[model samples]
Target: MTFHDREEELSALTTAFETPDHEFYVVYGRRRVGKTELLKEFCRGYPHIYFLAAQEAEERQREKFVEHVADYFGDRVPRIDGWDDAFEYLGEKVVDEDVVIAIDEFPYLVAENDSLPSYLQSFVDEQVRGTESMLILCGSSISTMESEVLGHESPLYGRRTGQLDVQPFSFREAREVIQYDTEDAIRSYAVTGGTPMYLTLFDYTETLAENVQSKILSPTSVLYNEPEFLLRTELRNPARYMSILESIALGHTTPNEISGATGIDSGPLSKYLRKLQQLRLIDREVPVTASAKKSKRSKYSVADAFLRFWFRYVEPNRSSIEEASKIVYENTIGPDLPNHVAATFEDVCQEAIWNGIRHGMFDQYSEVGRWWYGEHEIDVVGLSPTDDRILFTECKWTAEPVGIGLVEKLRAKTKHVRWGPESREERFALFSKSGFSDGLEQEVDDSWTFVDLEDLEQMLSAGR
Candidate 1:
């Protein structure tokens, strides 16, 4: 698959390299989020040495590192028993030149050698006054990367000139890569959700069900066991995290609710949720108008769309699921996939609206998210108290066209939202999958925006 939508990240790295000084950059993100790929793309055509670290003994890792360095330089390297000697020799060879030395999976090196940061700190200190070399340390372990290298208490603190936290693509950027129609794009985005690697596994020609069966439902497919593999690789207690994730996937959103579903004690549940949030595997949702620290009604949900789908449709039915079988997908998955995809439709609707605001297509808002208080729930809310403006959107993902009744239902809930003063200006909008009724548009106020999937796609795909 072709690389897509990282102009900002690539531009940042290029800017650091163009400077005539020593530069240290740390690039990190979730697993398979294109950290390595982005780094490689940035390194193209540069005099660079790239070494991928693995879970191995310190001595073996150092040996492999020296070998890669030698292969790049095409010169005989002296014996380097420790990191200090290794870096010293490296500094000696690449003296005062523009070269990039990127160490991928840097957390693995830190894991093997706890003092690896100290050694690198020394290297960076020397490079500061000595060479124009750029050192890029990249990793997938969000916790380890943040705590070990980027944390203030670490030896390498303040050593980095710049950092890149490579993130997943947005729905608009992902649509360019997936190359599917609006309907299937939503389905594919719900499954892949901006993760570049997973998005590439799908073919635009195939239907959503066909793609799901071959790429996800099949036991032999790469993504079939992806969530489990990632959990085991990243966490010490995969089973506990799995239970919490499965609970959230099953629609148990609150701490008490997750505890009730998993039978895990509520006291320890916060730690797991915090850890999952740090890992970017789950999201803690608070009302759009409320602060996270103050919101008592904050809820947890599986942050990764693919993982949510896996936990929802794949994990529960694993016992009865057959490899590469259509029966399971046809009978069970197909029935529920629409509802599953609907949840993401609400998210993208918010995203599209927010992106529109960002691009000056709409009024700027300070926040955009779901706002819920008991029985009153708004699917999408854009609030800017500074501007004394709030926008509410009613998003429907049903097969039939939406009518004025749904519009009226959304208006009824607006009075319950306790935001801004009574004099604040308000806006109403509707986003539908199957479009809206013709008469319904005329019935509603002319100021209101009624957007269907096609318009939403155009707005998003046109660089939202």
Candidate 2:
């Protein structure tokens, strides 16, 4: 509903606006990811004119632009008929003072007028090259924006000075917006992935069930149709995209698995994957060290939590899901969600370790991530980027105490992973939701840092 984050983006835009010369900047993101809001907020106080390109023909668009420029110019606003004239008039208005003129949904304009970018670029080269104004081209269609505006061969290529690929709000910022330690907060996060527009539906005071029933399950509510809206905006064939996304959500990560599950061939599926990846709705990742740029090792997953939730529960049971009542949906989501949450919890732990090393919480380490060799996979890997020192950790989300045998197994697994012969200084670490076994705890006098969930909470709380 309101801007709760993006201080950094706003600051960057502010600096750009205050800069000299004819500044051409582009801001793009997936649809409904708040690209327009960021631009609007950044352009609020300045002498600015905002024009959104629509799906109209070039002539109609030109007329609308003329009307908008006319409005800004008041009685003296020129009766310009073409985009070139409109931009020229805009250049005239801000000849002396620097101004921000934003054309939101710029791709639509380009679609309507294929030569729009070329025309603007030509206008800038001829009349506005030396002017003191900023032209922002903002769009939600990521692929089209990149190809049409920022591509190397694009007509507008090498013209724009800055570009912002606006992303969904991070988990930390989302937490700030809804500061609750309850399950509802986690569920809301898992459902929305910090998209401000979607997260606003979550009432901080209400239970997760209440929020879901009121906002998501209700036929008249905004969330009930949210998936369709997003899917429609991002893809041409919503059914195919929905199938691919649901397969990934259901744990079919590999191309073959997704294809098998969705009954789509891998050849056609790759295109969908690319589109989804470009939209930032899903991620295609390797095992952190997989060599091939695109191979079978690459696994696909829904990158946004909200999209993941939709695919996992809502999309799969669209035909008969609501008939089962809110209680059934809640229970179904409840059981499998903690496992997903656990994976994110491990990610948080990895970040904590990195943050710790940055703030002197640990003496040494370089890299950290999921590490594996053959079938043995370790959750945390801390390798000294500066030195040969390496640390391996197994993060667990259980109440049971991690015993010495688990450490021994991890040590054995490490043997397969290469760390050079001189990597004798390697140490082992464990992060647990519960705590360590007493025998293992006594053994780890100073050789390791046995961190429990409470300890991590304390460390995070101290902001060290």
Candidate 3:
């Protein structure tokens, strides 16, 4: 709950601050992933001046910036009209030690004045760059930050000493935020994502269904309009973005399908998708070894669980939210969530299995992912990149026992799919919630592994 897994980034930032010379750093990420929180936490005990940029006229923003500088300096300070004068005054005011200046939502500041970057570059080159002060620029829009500020052609391109793109908390870190079973934790993660704002809404003590109803189903809630806020900030056309997001939520992943479903031209859709991917709202994936730029088999998905939930349920139920109607919202969202959560649970199970493999707990797989060819889809597939060894697995979220019949079905589904050189040497695995049938468990040969929710839970607990 308290800054999990950010020690490395924080240490780097600390080093930048402790250096004898000036340090300029850029911190960017998708919205609500705690970029500002991390900076504020790091600012503790330091002589720091923090100012957030508001979407306002240039003159008003300058006044706001001047007021913050005056407050940080303590008492009635000089009146300044522009950033250049305020920065110059700070240079003349400070005598000894280091000063930390953080500007949150720096992109918004740049938008207010297109020449601000050049002005800052000139100021740093002429004055601020020679001092021991540390200047940090923070923004939530990755594309704008990277292009307008950090891009090679930008005025401040090489002026910074460090750059940090802080991603969401990992699944391991997320588990500590709540105490749910393996499957339930994954379900929560998939829906809430690793976003601190969304994760804070989850009450681990309650059932998943209860949490959903309490956090999301209500009329006045923090997250009810989250998707809208994020979309409107990053995009000019919220309707077009919603269409693409809804299409992905409804199980369309390819560009062709998304364009076809949304009626947006594929050429223009690419821009929207790229922006969303930069914000971490969606993800574009290719086969593990595929080329980074050109991979025909690449697919896109709504990577954020809460975004997916909103697209699948809340967006479709817009009328309900507007009309303050609960009957339609609950009845529609209730039954569908389990199936959705169950599929996501399998993805979490696979992620857990990969973590085990990484730590040398499992020697079977060197690579793991979902495999599909035509209509044949394997929920979980692990293949050894070295020896070409392969493992096929099926994950069941039901309470009923997983009988040998399920295994037979897996075998049948995989009949046309060959594994390495010898099919006989291939391994089989079953992951279940209620676990395998007793007789069926006895029937499996030594070439298979049977793991249930309890096993996964124990592994996670031990790892923690």
Ranked by lDDT, top first: 1, 3, 2
Among residues 3 or more apart in sequence or in different chains, the pairs in candidate 1 whose N, CA or C atoms overlap within 3 Å are none
Candidate RMSDs in order: 1.4, 2.9, 3.0
Clashes of each: 0, 4, 0
For candidate 3, report its TM-score. Answer: 0.89
Please give the distance, in angstroms, between residue 24's alpha carbon in candidate 2 and its true position after superposition.
Answer: 1.1
Writing each residue's lDDT as its tens digit, candidate 1 over 9-125 gives: 999988888888888999999888998889888899588999999999999999999998888878775688799999888887778457999999999998888998998888888
lDDT of 1: 0.87
Q: How much does candidate 2 score in TM-score?
A: 0.89
Candidate topping TM-score: 1
Off by over 4 Å in 3: 1-5, 19-21, 74-76, 93-95, 128-131, 288-294, 321-325, 364-366, 411-428, 439-441, 461-463
lDDT of 3 by residue, 1-464 (tens): 35545777888888989888988899998888888888888888588988889899888888888788778778486778677887777666554547888999998888888888887887677777778988899998787898878999899999999999988776666777867877678778877877887887778889877777668766677787788888877777788888899999988899999999999998999998987787678888764434448868778888877888888888888777667645654677766767777767776678767877766656657678776656777788787867767778788888698998988888887665655565445778888878888888678787777888887766555555
Best candidate, lDDT: 1
Instruction: Give the per-residue Cα lDDT of candidate 3 at 427.
Output: 74
lDDT of 2 at 40: 84
